[model samples]
Target: MLPVSSELTRSTPVVEYVIGKRQYRSLLEVTSTSTIRGVKKKIEDKIDKPMRYKFYVKILLTWSFRQLTWTGLQENRSLDDYGVRNGDTVRAILTRTSVTRELALDESSPWRKDVSEISDRDTGDWPRRLLHIPTMKSLTWRPGNRYGGKEGPEYEAPEYAALSYTWGKYRDETAEPISIGETEWPVPRIEPTHFTVHDFRRVINRIRRYSGTDFLWLDVACVNQGPDSDEGRLEVGRQAAIFRRAEKTYIWFTTLSEKDWPKSADPDYLQQNIGLFEKILNDPWFGSVWTLQEAYIPAYSYVLDRAGSKLPEISGCGDGTSFKTFTRTCTWLNHYSDTPRVSAARDVVPLLRKSGILAIDSGNPFILYGAAARRRATNKNDRIYGIQQIFGFQLGNTAPNKQTQQYDVNELEIQFTQELLKNYPVGSQMHVFAGSPNFGRGWHANEFSELPDKLPARFIDIFEEILRLDIRRSQNQDQQNRRGLSHLQCLCKFEPRQTESYILGHFSGQMCAFPDLLEAVPESSKVELLVALDYHKDSEVLADLESSVKYLEENTRRYISLYTHDRRRVVSNPGGFAFGKRLKNRHKCRLAVLKLGVHTRSRERSHDVSTFIGLMLMQESGYWRRLGFCLWRVWHPVEDYDKIQWTEEEGYFT
Candidate 1:
């Protein structure tokens, strides 16, 4: 490939720039003519401390790069707004991990392999947009077991890579033939390994020190810029690959050590150390499970927010793209069903994979054989110890120097592990699994109290199967680029509920659909006449949804039907989140869309055009066909509801 872009090491001394967290220092000088995003990456390496994504991380330009200076940059915007020259100390900083940790780094490890540097020709007018320095020459790059772009006892470090695209090529989505360097250009050897790149400015000082490159690989840095457009152009799959390649990947959990951080610009950066783990999941290998540090777990949910009624929004990892992350580097690598459940069953996609760190999938899919994916890998090593460690992360209980919010995280991990040991490890692989809370005192409400005795044996067997499956692919999982496992099914489950009339779902237990559709509203409103309940305006409407559900439980007897459907969307991750049919053609959604108490039945089925469903009845009186129109009628506590249903229908119907 003819080079559309190139970098050169200046014969003159290289000037260092101190911007935000990153300090920019490179052998090759850059100009404002390059790119705002590219310039940000170069600056990322010099940071002395680890910082989270600035959200909109900025570069305070200073020093004179031939022409560009801090004052000039503040006055104008855009890389092309001005030009940069060699020997210019362009101070720039990105809150993201811009430094590499070289201090006290275990240099004596047997597996250490240093990054090899690029030759003179490798840098000048290089046609290849993807620059890879398989080994860093300047630093005597050696793979190490501790961390950074090095190897461990069980694995060798993958080469460092960085991609440079001249926005011109990528700006066009429908461009002619695909160019890997253009669309998804893979940077040759930059940090010499993905681990060093992520932990660069964060754990240590310079990107070059960790490997040998001034450039940083950041998803936010490559985007067109701005939240809306950046989201559209960002390729999470590629980003996932980059994280997977790293020895340690940083995850952003919504909850921060302090409430001010989110609005403060930098998001939380939880480290995930999956070094040897890289070999376990070879799908576009990132780094080793051990080399991968932090073991960060970002929580992504498909939860809904309640305004007054229900605000349909998926909670945690809101969309599954983040969930589909490479096994070794993902958010909430493991979580229980009740920690916080998704509003939709399909939202399970991101949470279940090896990288997803999930214990369940679509709430209902677990019942089907589809949830058996957990059986593909057996964890011979005792994760129980690790699970206990997570429990140690109790909130407020955290030590003086520790973050307080960590407790919530540990609870989530423990819950997930407990569910897995009880259900997934049985001889039978769980194709679907659901999680809920283990509460105060009532043994009957305890999830396990009701479990059949055989359930434990079944769980053990399933766990064995998962180990065997992982063992078969262990070679790939442990290979240089840990190839991740796929073709695995995800599971999701919910506690059963009693069905109520005028509302969709069974009437015996917790409304199966309630977990997803449940919403609450303000208690103090003139509309209180409608619900006959007073709820606070700010309290989550779910609190009210729960109340209304209880109201229905105590007074109503009728039950409407429920069913499942498929759909897809990508909010943060990738196509990592998708819809799947757990129960095909089963009657569901017969809902209490409108509450006209006392089984207000309407004979006339309204539609833009009717009869679409009429002909099937002629064929046979199947159980489904025997059922009437699908409409949920609820029995409201208000007795007056019975008085208004027979109002004179349209003249013809009357």
Candidate 2:
């Protein structure tokens, strides 16, 4: 052991910084670790802005999450964390004096707004000089000789802790919230309660009355200066502290062009058709209302990149098709399934299918439509624009309560559909919404068709891309796929219009090749029907279909041996694959399996033979469709066989 080399005992120090050691180089990468005071020292060393200058330069960085430097410089939050390793490069350069002078002359000086640049002439004016410096509360930086990274001991500052603890009342699902003890750390909640009274218009008015005060808690306008992993871990906690602790959460729902929310409409609410109006620009009200006491608004909006809870405490109020909770959205991958966990950055519709909740969406348009409305925020279009659409409100025909509750809108939709699918279950067709994202007022006939023919996820991404389009050339309808998970800014309408011709065409094409799958099913004594949303039940359905197909092949294989693909000619043994006369669409589509029960049969054995056969047909159809087929058959048990009716119903024709 005594013979071990010196390398075994020697260790390197973690830091290189010293109080007086001056290092000179060019600025390579500015990061969140760079404190406000530290940045100033660097800038002072380089450009030599007058040592006595009062104000610091302010740079607004959007599209990138930033952390405030102690010296007032904005730095990227990501680079500050998991970076700054021993081998990472660092550089500091001497700044040009004239460059600093030019910076001092700029009117955009974030530090000393509207004041003359500090000069030799103002040396005697102590009060004016004092006014030039931003108060500690305003500046993001603390005095320092160099940029200090955001990762020292005690990452969760006291103030941030208080805020999250306050807002925790909103997002947590568990009502019985326990305190953060030594062992149990609190998980900061995301988004706000599903929906609150979302009268952004009312909030604007309220804040306007209290403007020009230091108390405003502007959520969209506050600083999220967390710089390290430890800090990020505590982000939501800070959000609760800042927002709930603030006097009011200023919710800026819309940007106003003329004292009102910017005029916009989305009958389809195609994400492509809408543009996000940044409040700072589209609405003049932002500046006025921003001056009020501590206020916060959850501007949950749609943009190229999904915004993190700009701060954890700040909830993003629903915007266009985007709804209340940006943290977790309810989307289904398949129909008859539950919601799935989705990231805020992507669209929810596809995620819905990914989670299996949307498994039946393509077939069960009823659930698909309701799920879509839920994702898109039905309340926005209805309530937010009710004043505009009811009694022809927008066309200058605003009248007395011209409509009943919006609940009737979706309800009337399903009832209207009953004229088509008479067997559909009542609750099976759902329309749940929170806040007036849409459905606040009347809709056109086109909106009604969304039911039964849930709009494709294709349209969702197409429209949300509108925010980033070159408006003049937006006519390029194909830019959709290149975009991220966006939505179609569509309203949930129930009045019928021609179902998208393309979708019907898709199904029709699929039906053309279904006969082969019918040949694959094994029919035992008779085919049993099985329909289960859970995958475990898939085996049961398959088992029954296998038996049915086997029996059919054994019994009817003689008769059904390949004539023209029709029920009339079961050519028991069509010598060879003989050519047939023209194929008929009638017989091809005639074999479709229609569903009578709204929910999947709980006890398949209890269903009457007629229902059982119907279930078998439905189950077979799904497999057939996947194999690219359309035709199927149904058979009843001997007891219920007499009660079965194979005759087509009037409205049941696809």
Candidate 3:
């Protein structure tokens, strides 16, 4: 025993210590001068454990296993003699002898009676008819008789737990045949020395004991991987439903071991254990594409380390007694901040939150597309098909169904975008465009270039519409604005009445309307009408402005003037003109300009000139009820319009 120093007894500092790996919150604080034997007594008192069993303390110096060392402390010596300090970890390992019988792995094992094989018919219909899921009889000790039972009644699908794990590289020669009751199933080719098979056996046994059910749904054993068939594709489509309907989902991380667990009874261990749990969550299982839905959709989920030890459930249901109830409650709690403590397995919470959003309103599937793009899939097509169910698209009936066109990735992407635009409003459509690669990354330019070649003719028209709304003029100077005012005049021979009266407006004084001035201006003069529209808050008004701009753009030679009060301009260029010089002076030419409001110094730099044009057209045509004033500006066509560097002051018709 080490000798205790005289200073240790004089001033004792309270030190926090963890008892075991499972109890993170069950921490005990004792003074530095407390004897090892005295600390044990306190632990017993805190845990309500009998003193008949012996407990030993070992310090954890580092998180890595290589750096971990155990130093035994004599029961009679104080912690100060062993160099114990405040906030140091002290692990308690029960030394009492207890016999734990391992489950026998023979052919006649009792678990064999509960095993069932998934039939081909069950795989055909998939989630709609979830009966007879496959279960492995034993992880080891394979028997020659693959099918142990005689002809019997077909097993109906029952409540079962689903396994989510990564399948590392495997070879044909490495495959092992394991018995599933009566059928001999070939286990994936995993190396034997790695103890994956052994760990799987232990996991199955523990799950059975804890869940009180022997039925389990493992993808490798359940899905038929036969070549030259569409069954695999069909199964992939039904993945969302399969995981959502499961009683519970188990996420098995091969990287986690006994070293990562925290004691359930030690409260001080809670802080230290967070780092270990974070490492466990970083395992490749969380990154796998197929595991995203599996980790989230189920009513209850649990995580297991390599040692078959279960991690604390992150979510809980109401009543908080059962794991399922606790998970349900925790899921709701995660949405709020009252409970700031995040669970170690909270990585899957985002997927759960998204699932809830999809269920409530799946009109905009753009977010789902973005989420799917971030994940990886073995088959390129599976990238889109895999997330179809999450967006509420049904995986049509079995083979020979006419709806197979939906499975095509190209067709599916188009359909998804089309549905998004159709079901949502114009603002939401803009948001989808902002999030999608086609518009977000400027990839739509390439799509537009391909035009009616790679894309459908209808899509070409759609692209044209979007372009007209986004840009005042296309790159090609020869083509007139397709939907401009000239086109509107050609389509409908309509004339407007002169407006001599004025009304109070929001930003500026009452002014004469533009339609009244149009009749007074000479037709031969280089006259241009500038219509400043309100593109601030109303979506309907914005849409009208877009239509009016398209009409004005068709007459390219005619000077079209527009100004805006929007602080942050949505459109890059408002007017068809290259520069704002044409509206700089009111004496140069006949130009009728309207101003609803003035642009502040901060907003002048990003102001959209076209927004004013659209806003003015809406007000003059009586399509918009808002008040505005009509002012006149002189147009001076610059010799080098493109070369002119117009400042913000000259850009706004002040």
Candidate 4:
């Protein structure tokens, strides 16, 4: 046993420690002079028997996973040597298997406090410069010219490779500063100062081995990063073209310590590495907004661990294990399940590929909105800037522009929503149920004028007329076939605060009544529903609604059901629907169903289910704002459309 410091026996400091990125919290008892290796042993022992997971601990500089004060803790060094104090939080990272290599792979030594001067000479309309890394020890950058489109020779042997990564917060004092003309660029190092020639060479060699290109175009190194930089704003607009023109793109996922690495000679090396790849897929790099287009635009993309190895080398499955294949496999694993956190990063590229909208430049705004919403950006406006390029349209104003400062997120969001609707073709019959109801410069209480104003005015008018016709027919039929069902509690008045209330109430009440009307009908239908609330900004009202309606969790795409206004007994078929937030102190809500353009394909199933997409709306200052969207699969054929009642013109609750 190692000797503890003789003077450190007063009281044991109980350090709080968390496990991995999931942050499973627990406590560690230690004297102030406990050696770093000894604490690691205690952490390993804390795990329940049967799972002997190995771990390495680092005292966080702050309450974040990104910033760490130490690169690797010396085994013989006591916690006090690193200034570890009582009640401080340390992260214990778990490796997949036993490690056999030394942990000297962090390549942050080249980064210094002084700025590296680079030329600001203009090259082309897009990427201004590219780093020419001919060898591991040499680094040179030169102006970059625009690539000839895909048919050009650049498609095969491109001028440069692009880099996509998360710019995590690091200690500002230790960050690398680069000067391009008048702009000062500060780049956060992935690891603290622990530079060794061997480790730095290993990183560069591995990147060279996988990417096949010596020239790299990284945003931090190339673009002007000043707040009011026109160059930065211009590059932001051309990101899509820059990425699309690259020979390939490299995604810099968090580097694993070389110390926890398994040897190639290990029997389970291949499987262990695959499992490690799966875990690292959950890294925060995958959740950044800018990486979405970076992953999708490149003809080929690679995932590299800065310290250890490239993904393909780790898999040992040869080049057959493409990045796209891995993401698709993970996405498929959680397709029927509700593991959105695991699937959120994997969903973007696959969904974009499936939509096939990129080729034609006409994409679905709903899909794009859903994708953008799932991602995160330090600056709220970056989300708008990042997604706009994916659709081949540049925002009128982009980052570093004075107009896009932090205080203008609401205005930016409203502008982005309007631009999205105006630029894309989402069918004249469809309307986007987006934006906060309480935002903007209108007396309607939101930035948006009514849906009629945004969409083709004639189209919304005609659609409303079709609903008016249906309501008149339903009223006439209701008088002739009047039953004593009016006594049933009106579904509009039924205030259900729980899923059980919705599930149980549907079976007990008259099917045609108000609150019960929103419930799935025909009993035989298989309905899968989900409610998505902005987890970070959710209000108590939305929290209660989410708890009351959600049967599944971790879903990015929300689902909900709304009953048709028609009182006729309808057969229901299995379908899925998503819903959003409701107003805090408002109960006067109504539903409107709009028919999407004609479905022409012949039905393959015995009975057809016509899909009716509905919106839950609330009146604010005489105009309506959407609460959420719902999809209903009621068994109404084309001939029976007259039975559906359109809510009254102004949506006055009956």
lDDT values, one for every candidate? 0.23, 0.24, 0.38, 0.39
- TM value for model 1: 0.21
lDDT of 2 by residue, 203-259 (tens): 323443433222222221123323223322222123322332222233332322222
Candidate 1, residues 305-411, lDDT tens digits: the string is 11111112213333232222322122232322113332221233332343323222221111211122222222211122112212121112222223222344334
Candidate 4, residue 62: Cα displacement in angstroms equals 43
lDDT of 4 by residue, 410-453 (tens): 55555555443333212211322323333322111122111221
Could you tell me which 10 consecutive residues in candidate 1 have the lowest summed lDDT? 610-619
lDDT for predicted candidate 3 compared with the true structure: 0.38
For this target, which candidate reaches the highest lDDT against the unseen true structure?
Answer: 4
Best first by lDDT, ranked: 4, 3, 2, 1
Clash totals in order: 155, 111, 53, 10
Q: Which stretches of candidate 4 lie over 4 Å from their true place?
A: 1-126, 135-159, 171-205, 257-284, 296-300, 313-322, 329-376, 399-407, 424-589, 596-599, 602-612, 618-627, 632-639, 646-654
TM-score against truth, every candidate:
0.21, 0.22, 0.39, 0.45
State model 1's lDDT.
Answer: 0.23
In model 3, the runs with Cα more than 4 Å from the true position are 1-150, 153-157, 168-187, 191-195, 258-274, 314-366, 394-412, 415-436, 439-654
Off by over 4 Å in 2: 1-326, 329-476, 483-510, 513-654
Query: Arrange candidates by TM-score, highest first: which order?
Result: 4, 3, 2, 1
